[model samples]
Target: MREILVRNTDLSEATPILAVTEASLAEVLAGLGQSAGNWCAVNDFSGRPSSCLLIPSAEGSGATVLFGVEETGLPHPFALGAIVGSLPKGDYSLADGFPDPEQAALGFALSAYRFEQYVTPSRKIRRLGVGKDVDLDRIGIVLDGVKLARDLINTPANDLGPEELAAAVAALFEKHGGAGRVVVGEDLLDENFPMVHAVGRASSRAPRIADFTWGEASNPKVTLVGKGVIFDTGGLNLKPGSSMSLMKKDMGGSANVLGLASMIMAAKLPVRLRVIVPCVENAVSGNAFRPGDILSSRKGLSVEIGNTDAEGRLILGDALALADEESPDLMIDMATLTGAARVALGPDLPPYYTHDEGLAEDIAVMAEAAADPLWRLPLWQPYMKYLDSKVADINHINTSGAGFAGSITAALFLSRFVENTESWIHFDIFGWTPADKPGKPAGGEAQGIRCLFDLISERYSSAQ
Candidate 1:
């Protein structure tokens, strides 16, 4: 992981060096004289993603750093990734003022992350020798949580079924000393998680509800529910081949929730944490639930299955209902629920829905601070009637045929089950990156985890 901290001293113990753009390379080096070493003259040549050089102590008293960007503005995230890995293992401090240390820290930490769970020979990484000001330990903790999420989402569906997902949750509980419970198979029917069972009945892996409790019970309660559809074959209402290609990441919501939970537990926040994952695999079997089927939910609401492909909302409804029963101080749910959300806001930004205006504003603040961007989408009350059904209490799919505001409708469906909660927020995330970016590669990404972690930290820190 990367370490970043505010430096207070101007250390004169190091070599003198100079960093210059291609246009000013000669003039900068000539003016600095022999006190700067031959290698001290680093270039800011365009086209370099992140490149740097280390000048020897012979001709210099202090090192000069040059960044390779077209404009003289805030440095890009991960700009120091390649340099951090290659710098000699020695104590080094930032010489100049940095406007954004968090972004720089994230870049360094994420660069060290490698998914080697199944590797024959584990990869080795060197410790980043940073100055005392840098809190590298905190950076490592955050990266570890992110890597956990990515590894879970990237695993094949065969190896990561509902049972396996539950087991993973159990591992977290055992590691953090939290209490975990899993209700599977017929137990779902007995416990009145009928909708969870119905949607999962088509698959060989039984549907289950994985719950975990942590922190002081007397503290303010926070409930997090994530849709853990391991693989979505679209059940009876199937998806096209391209859509099925990325269905393995349908469980990204679960991975993200677990990641955020890990951060809270590791940081020892002063809030009671409860994570509820409705784990299932939406597959097609002889017993698959079809369109027009009416399934009873944990909240006693009967939902008409207008479309089986819209199964994420069905399972989440039951989990949210159970979360609402606790009447937690705050309730948050995340899912890769709709393509329309991505089409409207692009893959880089996820749309979030919340009833509490202040809570949403706070989340936006934290999102900006953490650099894990998110956007707000309306939970329009006008569209509530779109989900109305004649035979059942509500329709699972919108009947308007044109499918307007897909993300809002999904959030509206979830809203029905969370009436009593003081604050409720829902996130529709892409979960997977189509291409690579600094720190975040083109694979399973931990969306919304950092922002939520920041929010929790701020809230509990204030209480302390």
Candidate 2:
């Protein structure tokens, strides 16, 4: 992932990839000499959003890259990422003109990402010289975290089922001096993760929950819960071809949480970190739990399965209940839980639900700083009536068949399982970038990880 960035290169021999904004275009062109200036005029390169113009050098083998951007005045933070796809195989340096070189460098790395696990990676030689001011090690950690989430989400479901995902989590924690165990198959029921077993028992792969912790015991306790629906076939209510096409990414929440966890541990943050992920595949079988089934939860709430497709919340209900037992300093859960969230905010901005106003405010601050889009949706206590059921403590989805306020209602459903924590936040993330943007490609994207990392670090920093 850091292949695009380099620390050392011969500047005199290497071609410079200049990020030219409208404000600096004239001076930049003048410095490039008359021949290159004439090339720009004929090409009509006026420094538009993603425009690029290559100026040949005295040596025909090399060329200077003039990448267009609006810089600080630009609407998108990663507009400079345009050069990643446009540049040819060569050694290049981002010479100047970006207000924030670190963000500009990060943008280059983001656009350089490609999910090439199934095929051979590109062997073309392309290296960038990130200036001295940028922290190369920090950027590398962030890139690796993003790559981990994207790779897990992009892999096919057959290769990434519940058992495999549990193994991945165990290996990750072990790598960072943390230890964890997974209660697999029928043992989940024995471990009181009944909802997890109920959702995954239909599949051949045994379902499991990965519970782990790291950092000093006396430090601030931070717990993270991610819904790991490896593949959601909507259970017996089976979705249409289009709806099920991307079900492999249903476990994206777990993938993203793991990415954030990787950053925290790699940085050696001074905090006690706990991660709880219930990995399950919502498949179909003759013995699969039916629509009317009332599932027992770890929290002791009987959840009536109003719709089999609403399996994420049921499993999360159990997982969140388990996490809240410790009443950690802060608890956060992420899930690709509802289509209603997508309809309301689209794919770019995930809606977060949190009752703690101070935490919400910090999230807002970090989100903008990280250029990771996140929005807040209310708990709307009045909507709790929509989840009421005569047969059980609560229904796992909107009780009304018409499906009004679906995202808010899904959040309200999870709220019931979390009561002990002083501050808890829920992220209903889309997790996939539907279309390619400046720094974001169209495949599995990591949402909220960057912003949340910054938030957590600030909250528990040694300086604090």
**Per-model TM-score on C-alpha atoms:** 0.87, 0.97
| Model 1 C-alpha lDDT versus the unseen true structure | 0.79
TM-score of 1: 0.87
Candidate 2 lDDT over residue span 1-464, tens digit each: 77777764444456777777777888988987887888889999887766788888766655788877666544467766766777777777877544567787788789888888889988665677767888888888888889899999999998998988988898899999998888899898888999999999999888889999999899999998998999999999999999999999999999999999999999888989999999999999987999999989999999898889999998999999999998999999999999999999999999999999999999998999999999999999999999999999999888877889999999999999998998999999998988878779889989999999888888899444
Best by lDDT: 2
Per-residue lDDT of 160 in model 1: 96
Clash count of each predicted structure? 7, 0
lDDT of 1 by residue, 1-464 (tens): 32332223434343221224555555655764664435543332332335556555454432544444323533565565555555554445443443244455566557555556577643343333234545656776788789889889989898999999999988997899899799999999999899999989889899999999998899999888889999999988899998899898999999999988888888888999999999999999999998998999999999999989999999999999999997999899999999989999998899999989999999898888777889999999999988999999999877888889889999999999997898999999989878766667677889888888888788776986
Off by over 4 Å in 2: 8-12, 71-75, 462-464
In Å, residue 331's CA in model 1 sits off its true spot by 0.7
What is the TM-score (0 to 1) of candidate 2? 0.97
Candidate 1 local Cα displacement, residue 283, angstroms: 0.7
